[model samples]
Target: MVTPCPSLGPPAPYVRRNVTHPASLSAWARLLGRYARCIRGRRRDENRKRGSGMEIHWSHVEEISEDERHAIEARLSALAAGHTDMIDLRIVGRGTGHHRHGGKEIRVACQVRGREIVAVRSADDLGLALDQAIDAFEREVRKLREIRSTHRDERPQNPPYLGIVDRVLHAAGYGFIVTDGGEKVYFHRNAVHGGLEFERLTEGDRVALNIEAGEKGLQATTVVPAPPGVPAP
Candidate 1:
């Protein structure tokens, strides 16, 4: 029989212990939850800052407070909400010669489609100047929209044409007139000229109107009853 190998030392006793401390486990979980919440909060803040597409530039101006900046952004966003064609908006603030004497100037520029619209204002305070500039910009945008809706650029300035009322839709507040050339034109009650009531119109009634290529088709504008004694063409 082979001799057994001698043991190097006495056998060590085995011990069992808890893999993790209960307090530490709970603390670790709480720490992870706090970290997750912090991350979400930061993301929300970032989204709020990026919500608007307008850009602001400051020149020779003092740093503004967060409240003031937020207020300005809210106003700009409100102004741009209804206009889908507005591609870009920029607001520039400048401090003139001196804070007390020269005051501040604000300029708001909007790029719509291929055109640019701008408004500028100067006031003793930056807030006042910005408000005035935004107001002016809003008016410009309204004017531009009205012009486009009427297609004023494409309308002809020729003399009015004579036509006869072909049909009237009393309930709908609109009517159609047949021109002397046999072209049919649409007219809304609002188009009646000289404050004439649309209800007064009847089939076969003579009317003079300026025509334009409207969104739907040929439409009459500034419609009025033909002058007495004018022979129908």
Candidate 2:
């Protein structure tokens, strides 16, 4: 005769006690939904703060108050306005040996188009030092923008023309070129192009160039070696 095991005889039915009503369940769901929305909103605000691309660092000093930090951030954002080339900015604050007397130093570094511009200032008060540093930083940024604008305005707009190096100031980093049409155009070391070394350039070297009217006078925006067998004009 075969015997049956006690564990396999029969399964017991499961019962849940104190079951929640449908209305209570709905209320809990709404509460949870509101909590989730609140969390998402906070995350968005934090993300916006990070997206500003500004950072502050403290060295041998305690962190500043939230009000001060906010003020600094606002100032930086205002300074960066309309400047799309700026990548990021960093501010560093340090306490001097006379920390008890409130001596502080502030440094601001700005990165723009792969270039770093920095400014440093020290004062009896941290706020004054920061203000001075920011003022210097703004001036540097404005100067850089002006220089870029000048370079853009100096870009050539016409085709290359044949010319001869009429004069070169080896110590001055500049020279003059006489074009085929007998027009003399000035060229700086920065204008040398086509892999040509400005240091190796000498008087009477045949070159091809594009000229434009500059703030001073006619200038060669680009300069390269002249092609072979090109008849001099």
Per-model TM-score, in order, reads 0.39, 0.41
**Candidate 1 residues 117-176, lDDT tens each?**
889888888778877888898888888878887896686553369889999998776799
Per-residue CA lDDT of candidate 2, range 143-164, in tens? 9888989897576553469989
Q: Give model 2's TM-score versus the native structure.
A: 0.41
Candidate 2 segments whose C-alpha is farther than 4 A from its true place: 1-63, 98-102, 156-233
- TM value for model 1: 0.39
**Which number leads on TM-score?**
2
Candidate 1 backbone overlaps, count: 0
* Residue 226 error, candidate 2, Å: 28
